[model samples]
Target: MSEALVAAETPGTGIEPVPGVSGARQFWRRLRAQRAALVAAAVVALLILVALGAPLLTAIEGQDPTTYHPSLIDSARGGVPIGSFGGIGGHHWLGVEPQTGRDLFARLVYGARVSLGVAFAATVIQLLVGVVMGIASALGSGWVDQLLSRITDIFVAMPLMIMALALLAIVPSSFPRPVLVTLVIGFIAWGNIAKIVRAQTLTLKGLDYVSAARLSGWGTWRIARRELLPGLAAPIITYAAILMPVNISIEAALSFLGVGVKPPTPSWGQMLTAADVWYQAAPQYLLLPAGSLFVTVLALTVLGDGVRTALDPRAASRLSIGTGRKREAKAAKGETEAGKSASAVGKAATEAGNGTTEAGKEGSA
Candidate 1:
């Protein structure tokens, strides 16, 4: 068929074809395709479960993380006897602390709770504040952007550790010092997230749909919320996933420095601090909490990478390799159609030539 005929016969829908997949579903599909993501998610989930089931996992009674068994402590050596995690049993599963003889298993489980809780809470705080400030900056006018940008820059440049130390120095020694640390860290860390979200929002606000929404008489709040917010979800969620491990590490560090969750309330950092002195006598004491922290951080880091990859359209294309759209099929179909068309045209011309030649021959005869 002629090009014009093909055009006439083709389906009409002037609008660009939207991809058949919803972003969230596509992201999930991509994540499910990745082995690393599944492994990381499983590890993270296990840690969360251990944290939540802290009490049930450990034997109740004198095994409280804070309750010390001086009898079990080797006073002469200033540490507890060497014990392997593989030897866990009735009284002590993971082992016992070096100097205090507190059940290591109980402390480890309880510590997970404190560390994960603070990290999650702090991340939520930072995410909310960052998203709000970011959207505000994008939706606002010249001076507003300038003011928010300047504020963001100031925080971005500030030293996080020094600021944390200064703030925590005045914080009263309390059972749940994790709360104060979380709030403070979240407040300080929001600036970077705001900057990221603001950049994304600025780009999104200029998109065609945003302008169309505004022209349709939508209010600023409605435009910001309905038009631009959804576009920001992927990056925000990915960044938040990465940031949770950071928050956990920071809380742990603060606890080690003696300004985080106070004594009696176990935290990974505090356990590390307490175990540091008896490393020579019982290496397991130091290694246990440190290993947990390392594993948790590693899992979160992997999960963040997976989430980012899954959410990214370009990255998803790579992961979806053999299972996605069949462009080769479309190419083959085109070639087949072209080959059939060429054969038909050639046959028609040959027949027409034969008919004319026969007519000429008849006239001569």
Candidate 2:
């Protein structure tokens, strides 16, 4: 069998291992080991798929969600009910809204698209701004670092929600598109991430590899990219994962305040708003979207925790140190055995020399 095949078949039989596993494989293995993280990831993926396929699913039932269907009210009044909620039957799995009798399920599915899209876009923007700004501040010394630090402090001190509300109040109505909302949230949310990146950069910039790169005539950008950035992978990924939930919450809050994606554009926050009146009566209306939001947030959080634990170099170093100590102890035993053999050889040589001298003296006599 091939070496690779043999390794695959045999438990713990493989090529010589390194100090740490390869990044991608290690991440996957760690994520899989974390049951909660895996479950959360699955739920998020399923929700995304459902949102993307909403159109096809809605079409199969032969109902137009946007169009007003008065027949639904008649069926509701009759109390016999034609559909799930006396509406359009299986076509509307979540029942119709009381006001317009619109398919709630369809709206919710469409809303998922908006919510996820906005959150993802915002997160990307935040990552870009925060990473760049942080690296710059950390590497730049004296006045530049001080200035950037002060700027970060200013942003961090501001009340984020209130600031968002104020900006929304002044902005034109046409600018409430998903992209715009993402940009707005991203800009404001970068402060915390920037601080994290800055601290990481400061630590990495002083590392031996970074200093070597600088001495080799590499520029600051090159050193940052080649020497510093690789070490930042764990922190960057963990932070990004943690940030997703925060961005989603921000979008939802904005939506709740009537400043988010407008009506007909379905968003989880907007859906929650629409269901507020019926929340006490039909709690499912509120529970559905809220539950989804909760699951997504929880999943990201767990995933972050898994990443943090898996990628922590200090923990890995401690494990390696323990392993090293065992090897050292074995070496010490081998050295002791060699010492005993050497001592015996020396004693035998000494006795042979003494006997030879005695024989010489007897011969002389």
Per-residue lDDT for 1-365 in model 2, tens only? 01111112222111222344565664455446545666767777887798788798778755544766555644444322234433535567776665566676777777778888888888998888888989999999799999998998888888878988888777888875677788888888788889998998888788787888899999999988877777766677778878888888888888978887777777888878877776654556678788878877777676666555445422322222454567667777988999999999999999999999999999999
Candidate 2 lDDT score relative to the true structure: 0.72
Instruction: Compose the digit string of candidate 1's lDDT tens values, residues 1-365.
Output: 01111111112111121256554555566677677778999999999999988887775633667777677666686555544552255678777777677778888899999999999999999999999998898889999999988988898899888899999998776534878988889999888899999999999888898899999999999987777777787778878988999999999999899888777889999988887876766778889999999999999988888887666534332333353336545666888999999999999999999999999999999
Q: Going through the candidates in order, what is the number of backbone clashes in each?
A: 0, 1
TM-score of 1: 0.79
The candidate scoring highest on lDDT is 1
TM-score of 2: 0.76
Residue 297 of model 1, lDDT score: 97
